[model samples]
Target: MRPEGIRLLPWLIGAVDLVMIALATVLAIRLRITLPIFSAAGDVLENTALASVFFLGTWLVLLVYSGAYEPHVFGAGTEEFKLVVNASFFTAALVATMAYLMQYPLSRGFFVLYFPLGVIALLVGRLLSRRVIQRLRSAGHFNEKVLLVGTPGYIGEIHTVLARESWLGYDVMGCLVPRDYAGLEVTSAGVPVLGLSEDVRAVVDEVSPDVVFFTAGAVSSSTQLRRLAWDLEDHAHVQIIVAPNVTDVSSERVRIRPVAGLPLMHLGRSRSQLATNDAKRAFDVIGSLTVLALTWPLLVVMMLWIKVHDGGPVLFRQTRVGRQGVEFTCLKLRSMAIDAEDRLTELEARDHVLFKSADDPRVTRPGRFIRRFSLDELPQLWNVVRGEMSLVGPRPPLPTEVEQYEDDMLRRLNVMPGMTGLWQVSGRSDLSWEDTVRLDLYYVDNWSMVQDLLILARTVTAVLGSRGAY
Candidate 1:
């Protein structure tokens, strides 16, 4: 059963979106009037207001049809925002086509301003609304009670994920296992086993849960699972979720096509192919140039500071592995003493894979400060501009580190190395080698432009908190 509050959430969001759309229209009109380039003849206020109502109604209908108001997408994921943007663009295009067909003199300026502004306003409103909803759910409001129907291992895995991601709004009530298990509770994860899977309907009636999640490899057969779903449909208001045993692959890469009453799931090509795509290369160049333009003054100051501190090279360059096992000169501000490399053997063990010491005597006082805040990374923007690295990717491995990598680990070299990446934002030096490899490989497998933007946003917080930085 969906939470009663959740049922009302879509209606509430629709109302809020309507208001935001109207506000965006008004702002667009005002902007047009103030800027002579967009000025037009006619009663601007009256015409614009009439246009706003028509566009607002049409946009709302599109949003509904596009699944922008779906409960599952409400407080999490980028799907809801993506739907809103798609709906807004489609609505704008439709409006333009209608105006042309009907021969109505609609202000070109109004729409030119409205399309981007409307989508932006709606996105902002939705973001704020999601924050409020997440806060409420975190405090034990609007959460669906879930009962797990799976093997012990599957139940444990699902429970761990749900527990870690509370914003997903699932509160695990308990689990139901095979009858052969004599225990009344799951000792491994502490969730009570409500009853055996054979008595699922009886257990459902007893527990009255809102959701029943069936993990892969749990049920005996699809027919049995289908029968259970059909039987429960008549008895309870329960939503069934089935995990398909797929991992590290996103929904966007999976295409479900039904042919001859059979559903076929087709997986797309690896995202590593995108590393060489023209669009990603363009983004790297543009993003790097923009950042360099904005931060040149700070770059100059850092360069001068490093020079004054040691009277040495302002920039430190090292040979690092790039995409496809290529080598490149990775640049950074010189944050250590001139003889820091010579002292490495005396200060620490040589057996480590990714080597760093917490209180290495080679690091000067200024070096410590710069490394903490990642000021040393600014020089890498030049590498990004030169196309040797991206603004975001797995960290470039040193030659020795790459030499030690196993076959699977070399997959990280499929994409260009980065100035900042999952490893950088997740935990610089504090993360274990295993975790670092996991994150880097995950990035390689599931790279998306949106993920890159999100990582870049999180990087600021990570640098400021300095939780795992050394």
Candidate 2:
């Protein structure tokens, strides 16, 4: 069942949005009045109050039409912000059109100030609301209880994901398995088998889940699934979600179409188009130049420190695999002794996929400090500028590591290696080889400008905290 607290989320968000909109309108009017071009010389307060009410009511209506107040979208994802932007623009345009059509004097400067202010206020309000809701959800106050109806393997995968992503607000209560499986519990995934699939209705009645996630092969046929849905509909308020067998592919790349009453999911190819590649390159160039400009002084200081500490090269150059298995000169601030490479074979292997040590003896004192906060990686920004790497992408693998890669693992080579990537912000040296590869591949599949910006933002926090940094 839906949590009572969660049921009130839409109302809370709507109230927050309305107040923010009204405040933004008033603020816009006050700012506009100061400008000679939009001077409201008399009765400013009365006019501003009327405008605030009109704008708030119109904006709220637009927001409702834009699906901003939908329960499914509350306290999650970019959809809320996108909807707010759309509604704001639409409301402004409608107001302007109405004034023009009715031959009423409407200050263009007022809208010029209002549109952005309204959107920003609404977005900030929603962000604050989301934070509050997430805190409540984390404390188990507002969460949708999920019941899994699937095989042990599928249940395990779904359960692991839901558990890891607690912000998704799904609390997996238990699972219902096929009758053939005699196990009472799934200890590997930590989900108890509530009942068999045949008794799914009874289990739902007993457990009273808000959501039922049916994994592939959960039922024997489409007919049985329909019957289960019908039974649940009459019994309780339950949302049914069918989990497709696909993994890691984004919704942007998947298209569902009905052909002759059969729904078919078409998967788009992974390769980026020319425009996307050009945009990515432009972002990399701009980001690299900006960072270089800001950090040159710090870079010089680090260079001198490294040279004074080791009397060796300030920069370390190594051959690393780039896109399509091509070799590139990867650069980094030298963080180890001159003979660190010679000691690689002497040290115990940490992992077969990526070699790293928490406390390698070859690291110099300065190296330890720099590597701890990833100052050593600052030089890779040069590689990004050189076009051999990106500001964000998969972690570049060594030539030897690439040679050891299985066919599936080589998919990491499909995109340019990055200076800081999903793997780096997630856990740098502490991640398992499998997890590192998975995160990298996910970045490859789901590359977006927003994702890169988010990773860069997280990188700052990760570096400052020095978590999982060696």
Model 1: per-residue Cα lDDT over 136-207, one tens digit each: 888888899998988887788889878866877899999888766756676388888888776779988888
Clashing pairs in 1: 1-210
Best by TM-score: 1
Show the colliding residue pairs in model 2: none
Tell me the tens digit of each residue's lDDT in model 2 across 1-470. Answer: 46777778888899998889878887888887787775554665565566666777888999999998888887555667778888889998888887789765556677688889888898779877876777677677678999999888899999987886677789999889887786667636889888888787899888888999999879988788889888887755688999989987756568999998667899877743321398889998999999989998988998999999869999999999998888989998998899988888988897567888888898888888889888888889888888889988888999989888988888788889888888987778888888898888777776767667767866887899898988
Q: Evaluate residue 284 in candidate 1 and report its C-alpha lDDT on the 0 to 100 scale.
A: 88
Give me the displacement of residue 123 in model 1, in angstroms: 3.6
Q: Report every candidate's CA lDDT.
A: 0.84, 0.82
* Candidate 2, lDDT over the whole model: 0.82
